[model samples]
Structures are given as C-alpha cells and as structure tokens.
Target chain A: MSRKYQAQIYVTLRPSVLDPAGVAVASGLKQLGYESVEGVRIGKYIELSLSAESEADAKTQLDRMCDQLLANPVIENYRFEIAELAASV
Target chain B: MSRKYQAQIYVTLRPSVLDPAGVAVASGLKQLGYESVEGVRIGKYIELSLSAESEADAKTQLDRMCDQLLANPVIENYRFEIAELAASV
Candidate 1:
C-alpha cells in the first residue's frame, strides 16, 4: 500500500507588510471586553493529505509548491510540515 | 471572583480579496508531493484571555474590538468565540 502523508502549512505576511485584518481583530477583541489583548497578527493554516512513496519525496514536493504557488515571495512567507501516516490498525 | 473569558478569533480575506499568501501555500503543498491537495486558503487564529463581568459584556467588547482593530472591514472578515472559565478544579 502507498504511504499517506499530511502537510500543514502556515502562511503569513512579512512584518513589514500592513495587515488591516490583524488590526481589526485586535480592536474587536477589545470591544468584546478583552481589553488586555494586544499585537494581533493574522495568518493562514492549510492541511493537506497526500499519498507519497517516502517522506523525502513529500517534503520536496511541498517545498516546490510553496515556491511556485502557495506563497508570494514579494510579501508573504510560509512554512510547512509533512508527516507520514501509519496504516490503520 | 471575576469571570475569566477565552476568545478565539479567526480572520480571513473576503472572497473578493486577492490572497497571494494562499496561492503560495497551495503551491508549496503540491511541491511537497501532495498532488491531490486543492483549494487552499489562509487565515489567522487569535487566542485571548480576559476578565469580564458577564458573557454578554465580553461579547459586546469582542464585537467592538473586531470592528475597531482585529479585522479590516474593507478587505477582510473575522469571527470569534468566547467562553467563560470555571473556577480552578
């Protein structure tokens, strides 16, 4: 049977980029009675499951995907994790 | 004793808003050998702990915060959850 892999990617704007969403969420928290909330930044989490021959191959594919499509090198950055799944008992 | 509240806010770009970060992450996953992965979008999760008199008040404050800071009304949207904590067990 082919091995299954799971990848979780987190993408966020570089610190220099302006994030209006982060600002708004922080303001909303304060209004919701969370006065102590501060310095909120927004990012994305993506989870994917795939079939691969090995962990090394999976990592290579994920890296290429990030470079070609998942992240914009001009303004954003991304990180991903790939894990192999064991067959169900 | 004052009530403690936990709020988690998720922020995302509106459907119409262009997300370069989302695109990058999707591509990254594919490179990592996840050929089946599709339609990846990115967002933010914010966790906050606050003291409030009541759930209603916490909700009100959180709403205001979202409106004022946590989210950018023009390009992004946000949603949050608030739960009260019980005394230490």
Candidate 2:
C-alpha cells in the first residue's frame, strides 16, 4: 500500500554567499521609490508530491532528494516540511 | 518614529502558467530513482525588512510592493505575512 505526502522545500543561499538577485531586487525597490527597503533575500520554494509507505520514509527520501539535486549544498541551505497527503475520497 | 517589520512573501505561478522548471525538477527526481514524484511546482520565497509606522502601514506598503515589482501580476500571485520587528532590547 502507498501513502501520499506533500513536501514544501525552501532553498536559500548561505548568508556568506553573495546573492545578486537580492541585490538587484533591493535596488529595484529603491528605484521604484521604496526608500525604506532595507534588505531582501531571494530563495526557492518547491512543492513536491510523493507516495511513500510512512512519514519517516517520506522525510528520508525527501532529504536525500534535496541533498542530491534540489539544492546546492555548497552554496545554499535547504529546509523542508512534509505532511501526509489528505485522502481524496 | 519608525517601527521595523518583517515580511515573508510567497510568489507562485498561476495554474495556467506552464512551469518548465517544475517539469525539469520532476523529471530530475524521477531520474534520481524517486519514481513516486507525482508533481512539482517551483516558486519564489522572499524575505523583506522595512520600517513603517504600524502593521497596517506595513501591509499596505508590502502589498503595493508586490503589486508593483516583487511579482509578475500577469502570471504569478503573491501572498505575504507581516510582523512587527521586536525591539532588540
């Protein structure tokens, strides 16, 4: 039997890493007359649907997925939330 | 006087938009031996810091920011949460 799960992953550049997109956005805001825009950081939000046998199994698999390709460990950090997919009658 | 506020903005593609990056990620997960990946959607997570007079002001400003530049209104929809920045001390 297979159980469904949903995962939301957030991948963000490490604080030490320079984020050009963030810089660009900040400047864009400034240009748009948002003088109070103090800072901005851009990150990736990924929503994934998976079928697994158990919550632990789903988490383990998702973690491996994040490490292998979904996120670049060297330059970014990733965090995720997993929830059982509600059964659709 | 200015009060600091933090806003977390989530920008997601509309249902009708074709997400090439999402397709690529789903396929990549499949190739990585996770065949249970039913679907994937990619979006943007942005963290913003601003100084405003009140929460209402913060929400208004943030809404305008999203409308004007943070997100592409044509293809993407954005939602945000704003909280007053606690005084450091």
Candidate 3:
C-alpha cells in the first residue's frame, strides 16, 4: 500500500534575471511610506498531495516534476519539502 | 539606522474556496502517470527585501502588508518569515 505525502515547492527566478514585478513592488512600498523599501521577487508556490511507496520515491518524483515542467532551468530555481500527510480535520 | 531583512510569504486558498487551478493541476498529474496523485493547490511565493529598525518592526510591517494587500482575508490565508539578509555571493 502507498502512503500519502505533501510538499510545498517554491520557484524563483535567478538573481541575474530581470524581475519587473520586483521593481514594481519596490516602488509601491516606497510610495506607501516604507521609505527603506529595497526590492521584491515574486514566485510560484505549488502545494502537492500525492501517494508514493516511500519518502524517497516521493522526492524523486517531485524532483523530476520540478525539472521537467514546474521550473525553468535557465531562469528559475526550485526547491521542495516532502513529508507524510497528517490526518485531515 | 536600519537593518536589511528578507522574507518569503506563502498565500493559499481556504479549503472551502473552489480552486480551478488546483483541479487542473491534479488532472495534469494524472495524465503524466502519477495516478496516486490526489490534489494540487497553487499559491503565490512572494520574496521581500526591506529595511526595518528591528525584527519586531519587520514582523509588524509584514503582518500589516499581508492584511492590507498581500492576501484576501475572506478567501485566502497568508504567512511570512523575517530574517536578516546575509552577504550576497
């Protein structure tokens, strides 16, 4: 029998890549009187729920998913966590 | 004097809210041969950099930011962390 697992994957653009959204947020903060505002980078947070034979198996699949479709190797970097799902309330 | 800090904010939909994107992702996973896949939730990962007087000030400001604009209180919940920025490589 397979056990369920969950993870949160965060993908962010590489530092060298230009981020217009970051610039906009910085300006917004400055306008709001957060004078010390510096910068912002927006990224994707994907929550996944899946069933796998083991924790290792879940991570392997997640790594593949991130590399193949979830993240852009040239511009974005991705990281994730894997854990057994707790009983739902 | 001000200190530089960074944080990541994660915002997700309340379970009751209908998530079309989540549904689509779940289906996409199934098609990709991840049959044990159950569900998916898509959220936003916002990385922030700013200057604050102290860690407490940063947390207070982040909380205010989330309440005012970063998240929709009625349908979504948000959380963030506050940390000092280290020297960049």
lDDT of 2: 0.91
Error of 1 at A13 (Å): 16
List, residue by residue over B1-89, the lDDT tens digit for candidate 2: 78898998989999899999999999999998999899999999998999887789889989999999999999999999988887532
lDDT of 3 by residue, A1-89 (tens): 77889988999999999999878877877777777667788888999998888889889989887787778989999999878985432
Q: Identify the runs in model 3 with alpha carbons over 4 angstroms from their true place.
A: A86-89, B86-89
Select the stronger candidate by lDDT from 2 and 3: 2
User: How large is the interface RMSD of each prediction?
Assistant: 4.1, 0.6, 1.2
TM of each candidate vs. truth: 0.55, 0.95, 0.90
Sort all candidates by TM-score, best to worst. Answer: 2, 3, 1
Q: For residues A1-89, could you state the per-residue lDDT of candidate 2 as single tens digits?
A: 78899999999999999989999999999999999889999999899999998889999999999999999999999999999976542
Off by over 4 Å in 1: A1-89, B87-89
Highest DockQ model number: 2
lDDT value, residue B42 of candidate 2 = 99
Clashing residue pairs in candidate 3 are: none
Ranking the candidates on lDDT from highest down gives 2, 3, 1
For residues B1-89, what per-residue lDDT tens digits would candidate 1 score against the true structure? 55777876767779898878767755765676556565555666666566667888768777777676666888888888888776432
- Residues A14-50, candidate 1, lDDT per residue (tens digit)? 8899889878766765666566564566766665566
